[model samples]
Each structure stands twice: as C-alpha cells, then as structure tokens.
Target: MGPLIWIIDEEWLDYEDEIRVLEQAFPSCAIKKSGYDYRGDLDKFGYLADAIISQIYVKLDAGAISKLEKCKVISVYGGGYDRVDVLSANKRGIAIAFVPGYCTDDIADYVMSCILRANKPIDSYGSALNDRIWGLPAAGKLRHRIQGSRLFIIGLGRIGRTAAAKAKALKMEVSAYDPYVNEEAMDSMGVRKYDSLEEGLGEADYVSVHARLTSETEGMIGIEQLSRMKPDALLINTARGKIVREKDLVEAVTNHIISGAIVDVVAVEPPSFDEPIFHCPGIAVTPHVSYLSVESFKELKTRTAENVVKVLRGEELKDIASV
Candidate 1:
C-alpha cells in the first residue's frame, strides 16, 4: 500500500498544492484529508494514514497524541510548532518536520509596520487635516518620531535581528536582549547586548518583543516592564501572543503609561469583542498575519511536503524542531 499523508486541518491553498507536487516526486505517496481538527480524533486516521500535515499555530492536546497508531511523521505548515507536543511525538518515534527561515522576511516586514504605527503619532494625522496642524504635535504635547528613537528587541533570532536591521536603517538606536547570544554576535549586528530585561527596557524609547513563548515567557511583559518604558515609547509584539499578559497591557495603555502598543498575536485568537486590550485606545491589533504572504505560504507548503517526502524516503528532513 502507498503511504498516506493525512492533512489534519482544512486545505490551505498552498499546502494542498504542495501535496500534489509531493505525490509526483514520490509516486508512492497518497494524500488524505481531515474535515476538521484532529485534536481528539487521531483514531480516525488509524486505519488509513501514516503521517500528518498540521496547522502551524493550532495546539494539539495530549489526548490526540494518545490515539495515533500508524502515524510516523508530522509536517508542520509554518515556523512554529507550539501546537504539537514535541516531547510526545519524539517518544512515539514520529519525525516532526517544518520550515522556519521561510517566514523571516515577511514577518520582519510586518513588524516594521507594527513599529511604525507604535512610534508614529497616529491621532495627530487626523488632527492635522481638521485642525490645520502638521506631523509634529506643534503645541499640545511632545511629538513622537521613529528616526531618533531607541529600540530594544527582546530576542535576537532571525526575525528579531531582521527587525533590528530595519530599525537601524531608520536611524534608530537598536539594542537587543537575548541571553543565548554572546558578545561577538551582538557586536556584529552593531547592537548593544543587555543581560537583563530591566536593563534593556530601562534605556529604550521603544520595545520590540520577538521572543519565543515558553513557560518562562508567558506573562513576561507586564506592569513592571511597561512602567520602565518612556511615556512616548512603543511596544510591539509580532511573536507569541501569550508572552504578554493581556490584562497588564490593558492597564498600562488605559493609564497612558506608554505611548502605544501593537500586537499581532493575541492570547486568544479572534479575541472576544469585549477583550479589553482591543478597546485600549492607543493600541494597534493585527490578527496574527505576521507570517502571511502568498509567497511565504508557498514556500511553507513546498518545504513541508518536501520534509514529509524525505522522511518517507529515509532522507534527511529540512527543518525539524527538537523535542
């Protein structure tokens, strides 16, 4: 029998197209589709499939892992694998594969837009048209501008570093905090390295969060960190949603502590209409579209299918996250 690649989520136009390409490349591979999330229904594929193509950001509960019998591989659709329990998959002898660098360029572009919104005086734009003012807040308050601002990035990974480069090109002073990165790397990026979050936030006119979301990072940005930012500072997060405590940001922005904030990932997707963070006047919200672009999506799908085919053919997988 040919190997069946089970798609756990509905067809992503990019991913399905890649599956077709993989079938041609391998010829022994057949595709299987799951109508809804297979979170609690892994057993459904027990008799028909051998692997899974999982959604990038969705989480797969432990119950789902307990049911799979024939599944020997997992192909993640995007940069993140927070959805799949890597430990469980490893112990079960499944090869979990994904594509990472694919999203760096597109995500960096999105972060730049988020930072631009965070630092620019958006309200002033409207007032300039009606009240005959210009980009600067000529009378009522001090103005905000991106060119001379100080930007502190939380993580120095690909996306974070890319953002730092853009920030530098804007003539902003860029610094980064990532314990894993050593002095030489920091020097090469022409960014100062900080050993602690407080040290990083203390000197910034802006903060860009690009860290991964782990137990240690959940609620990482809260009241204390917000308090350290300058009154005109901007906080931007295009990374994980849970890394910032939603309530803390609500209180900070509501109290006018920082200048403004922007978030692409939310603690919950499609946050409730009443999500206080949504109504926070100075915040810009994006629906986790940071890694979205037709070109990037195509790369993601092609890489995911290629990874799956490699495992089936006993070749090395492209970008498999470690357990």
Candidate 2:
C-alpha cells in the first residue's frame, strides 16, 4: 500500500487518458477519482490523501482544505491558481504548485488572434455574404487596421511581453501600464511605459489585459476605467475574469462604450447560455481556453504529475505558489 492520491475530475470521458498518464507515472501510489459537489463532500473518501490534483472548475476552498487533513500538496494543472485558496492551503502547511510559463506562448497567440479579429471585418463580411450581399461596399468595411494601431497592454509580465513583441512585429505601436515593471525593460522591448492606467486606456486603439488577479487588481477595470477607453476601441482579456467586472463589460459592449470586446474568461466559468454578454453581438466569449494547445496541454499534465511525485519523494518542488 503506497500513498493515496485523489484526482477530482469533471467527467470520466474527459480525463480517460490523463488518468492513465497519472497511473503510469505514480505506479507506487494508489490513485482515486471522484467528483465533488459541496464543500466538505470530499471528506467521504475515507482516506487522508497524500496529494490532490485538479484542473479548472474544482474549488479548493478553506472548508474543502480542512477536510484534506493529510494532504501535503495541492497541484493545479493551469497557469494561474486563482480558483484555489492558496493562502488557506499554506496555513495548513500544504504546498501549492502551478505550471507557470507553460502557456505563455499559447495565451499571447490567442490575444493576437483576438486583436486582429476585432480590427478586421471578417464577421461582418461573413454575415453579409450569407445574406446574399455582393461587392466590397456591401460586404463590409473596417477603418481600423492592425498595422499602426495603438496597443496598450495592462501588465508587462511574460504573456504581456510576448504580446508586445508580436504587436510590434505587426508594426503596431505598443505601450503598457505596469508600475511594477522597470521602464528600461519596457524600452528594451520597444514598448512605451505608462505610469497611469487611465492614460493608457484613453490613448489606446486596443487594450489587452494580462494582470494577475490579487487584492489590488480585482475589479481594476470597472466603469471608470472603461469610460476612459476610446468609444471605438477593442478590449481583450486573456487573464483572470474578475480582473474586469463582467457586468460592467457587458454594459460597455452593449452601449458601444467601446467597439467590442474579446474575452476568454468571465466571473463564472460556463456561465448560463442566456447570459446577457453571450446574447450581445459585440461581445465574444471563449470558454477559458486561451491557454490550450496540444503541446501546452501535454506539458501541463506531465509537469503536474512530476510535481506530485517530487512532493511524495520529499524533493524540492518546482513552481511553488504557496510560498
């Protein structure tokens, strides 16, 4: 009998192959898979798990953490661990690990795709053609082009820096607002630094948000920030959802406060289909898949398993977020 490991899963079909990988990686440990509904439901497993691994949609709140009395580590298979209560887990002396820098390229690529999509008339042309409209004039017209467009990045972190490089490659003027980042670093990447977020919002034709979700950043882009944006600008958020208020965003897009928005996340994952933002023509929402790619997905799974193994062996764990 080896250490007990429990994998909180979404569905058997989804984790079929991933579970096999974990089994092969930790043949010395007994792994269990179960679904959790309520806060303390995971306590019914009857064994103190040595470690717990989960993907998105699994909320490891303080109550749930209390039930995992023997849990030594919590491994999250994603770039961000906002879904998990790291502070609470740390109080229990349980280390939390997340796969960072694994999805930087994927997220940056997705942001660029959204930026280009917002600037082009692809949707308008497709809709017009479906209606039997002919000719360029009837098809669609777009005044904003990708090249020479002003791009303002909200955070100059890994993803933000990658986005800046891509935007510059397209001949777009790139600027960023991150007081924590050094001005010399921004200049090296050909990005202008803005001391104030409001100034950047007022000047940008497109804004991409990559800031982490923390006490100071939650609801950072509320009504006042949105109001400062150009009426014809486009806003992109590939970072956390709560960083920008979803209700305010829906209102902004519906009222054309900004031309439109491309959001990969929202306040709630798998929001109701009847959500107002989904009904709006100007707002496009992806199901939090901006960090997805065949390569990144495989890496995330492998790294998560490795991290757990390291914890079991009492080795130094990589990407420790609980610190």
Compute each candidate's TM-score over C-alphas: 0.90, 0.93
Model 1: lDDT equals: 0.78
- Model 1 clash number: 0
For all candidates in order, the CA lDDT equals: 0.78, 0.83
Q: How much is 126 displaced in model 1, in angstroms?
A: 4.2
The best candidate by TM-score is 2
> On residues 201-238, what C-alpha lDDT tens digit does candidate 2 reach at each position?
99999999999888899999987899999998989999
Candidate 1 Cα outliers beyond 4 Å, as residue runs: 10-16, 39-41, 119-144
Instruction: Output the worst ten-in-a-row residue range by lDDT, candidate 1.
Output: 39-48
